[model samples]
Target: MSERLRLYSYWRSSAAYRVRIGLNLKGLSYETVPVHLVRDGGEQHTPQFRAANPQGLVPVLVHGSRTFRQSMAILEYLDETWPSPPLLPGVARERARVRALAQAVACEIHPLNNLRVLQHLENALGLDADARSQWVRHWIGEGFAAIEAMLAEHPSTGRFCEGDTPSLADCCLIPQVYNARRFKLDMAPYPTIERIEAECLALPAFDAARPENQPDAA
Candidate 1:
């Protein structure tokens, strides 16, 4: 807790949202440096941001003088540093399960539907609004369907994605559900996913990490 912490975040960025939830759950205090991803050709693309992260991405965490990029890495870093209320499970197999569930969303689902991809789909490929909507829905449905099976059939599943208490998977999940709803994907198909999302949001940490609650939401 001695070292100062700061997060470079965009309001609606799902990757950033995941880190926000992790920090909140750990009860750590940090500064939020809002980097507007959409204002004036994205502050993230500026030379300054690229200096912090050559990839030009948000959710960069500065712990002391060390800088960390990529949401998954940041989450693990927090969990390892704090070691309280553990973002990951203790058992080896359970930890693997938690990470697998998280990757199912982070790797399989989000990459296909992130902002840059959507923008390229519309602006570069000239997809119409309806086509874009279809694109979002298709990818979400594909991912959610697999996640639904992972949760519903697995005995380890509980109130949250991995267990009753929130874990790394829940951090990845809530934001993706937010995106799914924004794109008007029907929720009826993924009852388990909806139920887990509700449980996670009921906690103050997850609620505060929501897109609308961030200072730079506009």
Candidate 2:
């Protein structure tokens, strides 16, 4: 029996974008429930959405009667369940390396520049547009600098973040790159990242999973 998969996603949300990439890579057909993050005071804050995920975040995956939160967790679940075209490598050491690379973007870089953080900067910190943009750029630059060094110096770096195939790291990295470019961060400083992103985007899965290509993209 095929498990029914449904994804609650926001078009521009990087977290949601990561899940989309994972789903596409696994060749899984899933329904996308567009959760408009910016319309009418944000749909993710609605009572119904809050019940689904108390965190009020996008990329909530409903698999059968089970619900999953967090994009990284969802990716791991899907990979374990499907097991075709695996998202992580076979070796334990390589899996840890891939996870570390993924976390470099997802955990370190993304948290600082997420929508809620930016909203807090505006509503609480009273930062204007320019200052907020600078804040985002600073954090992204700092994280990307470290990631660039990691990728440039590592022997495992190839067409993707780990080896020649796209893994969980690629799924995470591509969305962060998208968000960084949206904030007008210069890509020239990270040639290795740029090369990997180019390779990932060339695939049909990544291209189809882009924010602009989502059903609810505004």
Candidate 3:
């Protein structure tokens, strides 16, 4: 149990950023092995990294002999491995709510706006820089609009996406919020999300996990 956790991550990948927040929130120590996503046609696609993750994605976590891929799965693994400071709520229904909130961002929002999809748009689809930016803003706006309604109307929405404490939902949401702003998406419509993001960032855990704070972020 003395083994140090290791994370293969790209600095600005929001999926990777999500796992970083989860790790920090759990107070777990981990070594980050930087994988440059944009330089030299992407280090993640190289043979060495692909052996660690067949999918060639960021946030492949290694602990002892165990290797975990996919950011949400890694979060669940960490929560279960170190049960104190639970990422999901204790109650079954509450857990479901948290999972749904997390999935809305991880599943709905992220897949549409992730690096690969955007790259495909620009390379394969021949979308200009402006056109790609439009594509990003449009999808993010659509997702945030639904999320805004959910958080605004739901009684469970606290300072974070779920209760006042940062949960699985906030871990997923915070990184996406960062990415949205990077694309310059107009955030005025999602006041609830904006407030929750501010609250989450106030915590040391979330603050430490910002993409800019990552060592590879240059």
List the candidates' TM-scores in order: 0.98, 0.99, 0.98
lDDT of 3 by residue, 1-218 (tens): 66779999888999999999999998999999999998999998999999999898998999998899999999999999998799999899999989988999988888988889989998899999899889889988998998899888889888788878889999999999998999999999999999999998999999998988989889
lDDT of 2: 0.95
Model with the higher lDDT, candidate 1 or 3: 1
Candidates in descending lDDT order = 2, 1, 3
- Candidate 2 lDDT trough over 10 residues, lowest sum: 1-10
lDDT of 2 at 152: 96
Q: Give the lDDT of residue 116 in candidate 1.
A: 83
In terms of TM-score, the best-performing candidate is: 2
Off by over 4 Å in 2: none
Q: Which residue pairs does candidate 1 place in steric collision?
A: none
* lDDT tens digits by residue: candidate 1, 115-189: 788889989999988998899999999999999999999998999987788999999999999999999999999
For residues 8-76, what per-residue lDDT tens digits would candidate 2 score against the true structure?
998899999999999999999999999988889999999999999999998999999999999999999
Off by over 4 Å in 1: none
